[model samples]
Target: MHLIELSIAKFEENLCRLKASETVCSSSFSSISQKLTRLQDLHECVENFLLLPLTQQALAQECGDKWINELLDGSLRLLDVCGIIKDALLQTKECTHELQSIMRRRRGGDMSFISEVRKYLTSRKDVKKAMNNALKVRESNCTDKNHETPAVVNMLKELDAVTIAVFESLLSFIAGSKSKSSSWAFVSKLVQPKRIACKGEEVANTNELEKVDAALQSLVSHKSKKSDNTIQVEDVQIWLQDLEANIQDIEEGLECLLRRLIKTRVSLLNIFSH
Candidate 1:
């Protein structure tokens, strides 16, 4: 029991640190990727905590409780969200790769570039829609403030909430800005005389994903202009490569966390089955 308490305390401390970090540096590709890595570490700790003999005994005693059922349901939902994000990442990567290939080949001229750019934009919209649907799900709260829950149950509830919160952040990052403001509107800010005069450093700090988005919007809007003139094809390609690399890193982290989640779920099932 003492060891179990220590484990729970350590997990809570780490969770608090992650939440604090989120507030300070909410949404950059590097920050999101780092968050994913930290999440993977936290889930591994959870899996170890669940494997403790004391934890198994306690959970077994509470086998038929509502909280146990809630945990099981929450695990399934987490898995579902993981699957959706992984698929979205993969689709985006493939689309980006196709665009890069088209740019390199420059085979069919402006029409080909325009067709592929449109396809990539359409892909982004589809991914955003899927992420939004995933976000709409209201998770079951097993932690009741009015009713006193057991320590193990409370710890698990907090863990579930934190895990879901991290996933929500990741999903939102992938979905990009939801504001109706046009990508053109954003690009204009970059090139407008006032912005060009005053915003040198700030513009450089924008993420590769947004940079590519704005460049693509410019290309599509000015189809008659030479693509290189509208937005250097070379610059867009570099941004796409950077985006691809970051997405790949996130995907690897997600895969590891998904495995850890599965292990934790299986451990819970075994406890309840006994």
Candidate 2:
């Protein structure tokens, strides 16, 4: 039997098993059975087309074209599934934020409520896996090598942007609201000053370092003058550290992307040159 026919048979068998289960209601089982029957009808239609003579080249081509279209539709559906998973992750982040707000408002600071939210966060592993699997399916569908299509490249870039946006939004939300100092404090450590090279030579200007220090000091002095309730000096230091670290990471990622783009452009030029 053809692959579609086999799949239809398996679906029908599963539907039968589901219907036989004592736990399932009659109405639900009937609905599923009807859907399976429709799928079986589709399978029969495809089987009829396949049974036609090889001399009917146009009909064979039409069947092949329809099959390819169905494959593309399935792949697009996988992409939509990934989007749904991403939205679910965002909802989880929102729930975490709301829980944090509730904790802050409550006098006793209920630990159990926060714990429940953390548990929900932990349950996101399956959703993450589903998203990754969908991404893999989408990537596998793009087999063209000679011509680089905008759709393929844009899809990848959009996926990357969504991921980065989600992470950054979650981090910012947690940092701003959560009272659990450990979480934000750990992130602060990630933002610590590291030796970075701008040009070929190492930065040796004591004056430039002094200028940066002076600017930070001036900002602190201004804030202290303006507001009676200012953030703690330690917190300010940590925030600055984290900001620097994030800037470094962004710069590195940009450089890597630029290099890849340049390489692809060079390859394309060589292809045209030939």
Candidate 3:
């Protein structure tokens, strides 16, 4: 039990650090990916803690009417969120590959290029819509009924809260920013002479994806010269390729993490079902 308590404390500390380091508004693709990895680590610890004999005995002893119901519900919601996110990533990846192909085979002012950009943007809008729907699942599920539960149950509840928080940030990053000004700023920066100087920092900032998003938007919406449009298309293609690679890595991580989440949920069910 003492060891279980220590493990839970360490998990909470890691969760606090993750929250402090990245936020929904400012997180970059890479940072959010790192957060996903950290979340997996935390869940692994949770699985081990749950497997302990003493921990199982304690959980079995509890009446666990409200607390258990909330946890089981929260687990179901987490699974739902994970599946949606994975599908979104796959959808975005397909759109990205299509856009990259369009950019590769075509040059300036091609009607197909413009068409593909519209499709990609539309896909992004759909993805964000789905993510927002999933996020409505309620963090309150993790916080309610905590005060009256055992220490182990409280720890599990806090873990659920932090897990949901991480997923929320991940979903937000994938969905991109909703603010018009923020999106416009990325577009504006893309055409600037100094944008080349800041290329190194793009991966570390939320604007990495936004840069490609804005560049494509600018290409289609602006009446720039053919040569300028070609250059922008090339830049956008490179960025899209990079994003596709990152998305693949993140998708792999999410799949692994999803399995861990399922395993943890199953463990909980087993403890009380008997």
* Maximum-TM-score candidate: 3
Which runs in model 1 stand beyond 4 Å of their true positions?
107-109, 140-147, 180-182, 189-207, 223-230
Off by over 4 Å in 3: 23-25, 137-139, 142-147, 201-203, 223-231
Query: Which tens-of-lDDT digit does each residue in 90-163 have in candidate 3?
Result: 99999999888888888747898889899998888898888887777545653654456787887777778777
| lDDT agreement of model 3 with the native | 0.78
Q: Report per-prediction Cα RMSD to one decimal.
A: 2.9, 22.2, 2.5
Q: Write the per-residue lDDT of candidate 2 for residues 1-274, one digit (tens) a residue.
A: 2543454354445434433442333222123223333333333333333333431232233334443343334334433443454354354444434544544554222455435434434443444444454444443233332233233222223223333333233223222222334333333332233422231123221112122223233332342333433333343344334334433433343334334333333432332233
Candidate 2, residue 34: how far the Cα is off, in Å: 44
Predicted candidate 1: what Cα RMSD to the true structure?
2.9
The better-scoring model by lDDT among 1 and 2 is: 1
Candidate number with the higher TM-score (2 or 3):
3
Model 1 lDDT, residue 189, Cα: 61
Q: Let me know the TM-score candidate 1 reaches against the reference structure.
A: 0.89
Stretches of model 2 off by over 4 angstroms after superposition: 1-75, 107-109, 133-139, 145-274
List the lowest-lDDT window of 10 residues for candidate 1: 223-232
TM-score winner between 1 and 2, please give it.
1
User: Would you list the rank order by TM-score, best first?
Assistant: 3, 1, 2
Cα lDDT of all candidates, in order?
A: 0.78, 0.35, 0.78
